[model samples]
Structure formats: structure tokens, C-alpha cells
Target: MTPTLGFFAWIIIGGLAGWIASKIKGTDAQQGLLANIIVGIIGGFLGGWILSLIGFDVAGGGLIFSLVTCVIGAVILLTILQAIRSKK
Candidate 1:
């Protein structure tokens, strides 16, 4: 099993990743700090799972890799959400 990141690590990394993802997706203006953090945390989980499924080792990849993973996941998540919302 991959070792889990600590609480503060999650917050910091998640916030950064989420903020970046939102900016990339053009949704930054619609989200606040708390929302970014939450997106980041969830995006980390989603990213990790997707990477694992693709046979990538997500553990011990260090901070930069983790952030990249989270950003990719968050972008994907935001894309999906945007699509769904647009369809409504």
C-alpha cells in the first residue's frame, strides 16, 4: 500500500494542485480557497487511483510528482464536472 501523506501536506499540496487545476479549467473565479482545497484533496485520491489503474507506482514519487498527479486528476475532474453542468 502507498503510504499516506500527512494532514498538512495534503492541505498544502491539495490547495496548490486544486488552484492550478481550476485555473487551467477556467473555473478559478467560481471557486474559493476552501473549494480549491477540497477539490485538491479529492483530486489527489482520484489521481492516485487512476494512476494505479494504469500500472503506475504512485507511492514514494515525492512532492512534485504527487502535485502533478493531483493536477491532472483535478483537471479531469473539473472537465467532467463542467461537462455535466453544461449539459444541464
Candidate 2:
């Protein structure tokens, strides 16, 4: 079965996750609302992909699951961004 989330649920979780990740990476000052949402949703996708690659079952989960997964991905994303910026 496909993992599905309601629109509002997705937005809420994504925003929260993104905000938290930004806080962790010290980039909260650089992100706006829409950017947070976009980063969050994409982070979710990235998290899912990473989990799948690691042979973890990432389906049929709840908010905490999604939050943890997205946070991990967002951390990775922010780390990559910082690395690229430092190289520039």
C-alpha cells in the first residue's frame, strides 16, 4: 500500500519538522514560511528514500515517525547545503 498523508497533516508536520531542523542547523534565520514548507516536504521524501535504501520499513507510520524521519533528512540536507556553500 502507498503511504499517504492528508494535505493539512503533511503541511503541519512538514513545517514543524523543517522548523526544527533549521533550528538544529542554525539556519532558522535564513528560512521563510514557504521555504520551510518546501524543505520539510522534500525532506520527508528524502527520508523515505533513505529508509528504503537502508531496508527499514517506513510505511503506515504516524506523526512521530514522520517527524523523526524528516528531521534526519533535513539534517542531511542542511549539512549538504552548508558543505556546498563553504566550497563556494
Candidate 3:
């Protein structure tokens, strides 16, 4: 996908993934929609990179794979964020 298209796609995936992560982490009440989207998108990129590092390809397989990977990343990110916040 082109950069612009990929960005938009990530935003959508991130938003949904972030929402899911928030629910799973029990932090939904503390985050807004935009924050969730941003976190999810960044988390998706991070997750994809980590997966790639482990020799797991995240490309292709349509939106399902995208969403799954993004969600996984968002959950990780959210968990870390919660931990950091707790420390503060």
C-alpha cells in the first residue's frame, strides 16, 4: 500500500485495536477515541516490527491479519502504559 493509504489504514486498525486493548486492560475509561487510535497505530507498527524480528511475516492475508497484529501490539502497548502510569 502507498504511504498515504497505509497511514489511513493504520489509523482505522489502530483505533479499533486500541479500543479493544483498552477494554482488555481495563483502561477504557481513561482514554479518548483519538488517543486510542494513535496508540493502536503506533503499537501496530511496533508489533509488526517485533513479529518481523521473530521471523513472522505480517503482510498480506487482508484486514484480519492486520487487525489481529495491531490488536496484539495495542494490548502490549497498553499494558506497558498502565505499568508506567502506575509507577508515576
Candidate 4:
């Protein structure tokens, strides 16, 4: 069976995923480590969800796949956030 990830592991993954997403979204300058972690975790979830809806399984794709899905999700999140901010 695959080993379960610990809390720190999740944080690390989340931070990296978030940072990459922020950079892609052009919001890196406005965010920090904490924000990255938050975005990453949430993005991972959203990414996995979206991918699953599209008949993809990012969760089973390993590290690189995980990053890709997370990045996709983070970008989507940032896009929505930017749109909302623009409207306000």
C-alpha cells in the first residue's frame, strides 16, 4: 500500500504548488509562504476535483502529475480571484 503523507509533507507540497501557481498567475509578488500553502492545498483539492470531472486521475499520477493538477487548480483559483478583485 502507498504510505500516507504527513502534515509537513502536505504543507511542503502545498507551498510549492501555491508558489508555482502564483508565479503563473502573476500574483507571486502579492503573496507569501503562508498564502502559498493555503492556495496550494486548496488548489490541489480543486485541481483534483476538476480533473476527476474530466475523467482524469491526477491523484494517481505521482509527483509531477500532482504538481500539474495543483498548478491547474491554482491558476483557476487565481483567475477567479483576479476577476472578482477587478470587479470590486
Cα-based TM-score, every candidate:
0.94, 0.90, 0.86, 0.89
Which portions of model 2 miss their true places by more than 4 Å?
1-3
User: How well does model 4 score by local distance difference test?
Assistant: 0.82
Q: Write out the backbone clash pairs for model 2.
A: none
Candidate 3 TM-score versus the reference: 0.86
> Clashes per prediction?
0, 0, 0, 0
Error at 75, model 1, angstroms: 0.4
User: RMSD to the native, candidate 4?
Assistant: 2.8
lDDT of 3 at 84: 93
lDDT of 2 by residue, 7-80 (tens): 89789878888899999999999998887777888888888889879887778667788888888878788888
Question: Which numbered prediction scores highest in lDDT against the true structure?
Answer: 1
lDDT of 1 by residue, 8-80 (tens): 9999998999999999999999999998988988888899889989988899788888999889888989998
Give the runs in model 4 whose Cα sits over 4 Å from its true position.
Answer: 1-4
Which RMSD values do the candidates have, in order? Answer: 1.3, 1.7, 2.3, 2.8
- Candidate 2, residue 84: lDDT: 98
C-alpha displacement of 50 in model 2, angstroms?
A: 0.5
Clash pairs for candidate 3: none
lDDT tens digits, residue span 1-88, model 4: 1213567876888899999999988999999999998898788788888888888856567877777777788889889999999999
Query: CA shift at 48, candidate 3, in angstroms?
Result: 0.2
Stretches of candidate 1 above 4 Å error? 1-3
- Residue pairs clashing in model 4 are none
